[model samples]
Target: MEIKEHIIQGVRIAELHSDNMLLGSVEEAVDLLGNMYYNQADAMVLYTEHIADAFFDLKTKVAGEILQKFSNYRMKLAIVGDFKQVSSKSLQDFIRESNKGRLIYFAETLEEALAQLVR
Candidate 1:
């Protein structure tokens, strides 16, 4: 797993990347949050582009788990991507509702995700 941190418009956003499945289960999701907290990031923008191509079946579950973990830690999360490609309506609804909350968001672009985090 590779976690990179960046400050955009004063918001600390960490971009996480991994060849391994980052969130195959709830425990792994918790571990990722621990890493993010240790890094002292206010929000995370996980770059799953590579993983998405490699492990498509796990995407929604992984994303949902991350959001759940962040909520438990009182941390914030924003996934930047074009989510329309995801064929699951349930996941789409999950994304929509998560975005309505203060801690979770699904943004179409990194800029928008950064803006959401900063606000």
Candidate 2:
């Protein structure tokens, strides 16, 4: 896992780049938060493609659980990538709701995610 930090509009966002699936468990979520916190990042940006499929499966509830961790720790999370490939209406709805919030967002690109952070 490689974490690159970017400061956009005065907010520090850590962009996580990893070949491994980053969201396999709640423990992994904690680790991610740790990394971001250690880096003094105000927010985290993850490419959707780096996440595991299990994270999005509603039955598993990994997505909610992981996101809750971020919320609990008072960290912002931005997921970026082409979400059109994911064909779940419920997931789409969940993303929509999440995007409405200040802490969590689903964006099409890193630039878009950074834009949301500035807002």
Candidate 3:
């Protein structure tokens, strides 16, 4: 995993770049969060391609579990992806609702995610 740091509006954000899945399981999610927290990153930006497909499946409950950890740690997260391709209404609703908050967001691009996180 290569983390590119960005400071926007006095907030430190970490943009994760990895060829493999970053949040494939709860363990990996916690590990990634720990790494970012130790690096003093207030927010994180990650591409959906780096996340496990299970995360997009609402039935698996992986998204809720992992996202709860992010909330518990008080770390903001922005997932950038082409969500239009997701056919699940529940997942689409989840993304839409998450985007309405400051803690977590579902964005279509890196720039959008960064802007959302900074807000």
Best by lDDT: 3
Residue 59 displacement in candidate 1 (angstroms): 13
Residues 1-119 of candidate 3 have per-residue lDDT tens digits of 89999999999999999888898788998999999989999999999889999999999999999999999998999999899898989998999899898799998988898899988
CA shift at 118, candidate 3, in angstroms?
Answer: 1.0
Give the number of the best model, judged by TM-score. Answer: 3
Instruction: In angstroms, give how far residue 94 of model 2 lies from its true place.
Output: 0.3
**Candidates, ranked, lDDT:** 3, 2, 1
Sequence-dependent TM-score of model 3: 0.97
Whole-model lDDT per candidate: 0.72, 0.87, 0.92
User: lDDT by residue for model 1 over 1-119, one digit each (tens)?
Assistant: 67777797777888777776565556766877888888988888765563344223444465555456778898887777788787878777777787778998888887788788878
Estimate the TM-score of every prediction: 0.75, 0.93, 0.97
lDDT of 2 by residue, 8-118 (tens): 879998888887888678999999889778889999898877888888887899988998999999899889988877799999999899889999999998889988877
Clashes of each: 0, 0, 0
lDDT over C-alpha atoms for residue 29 of model 3: 86
Error of 3 at 17 (Å): 0.5
In model 1, where do residues sit more than 4 Å from their true spots?
Answer: 50-66
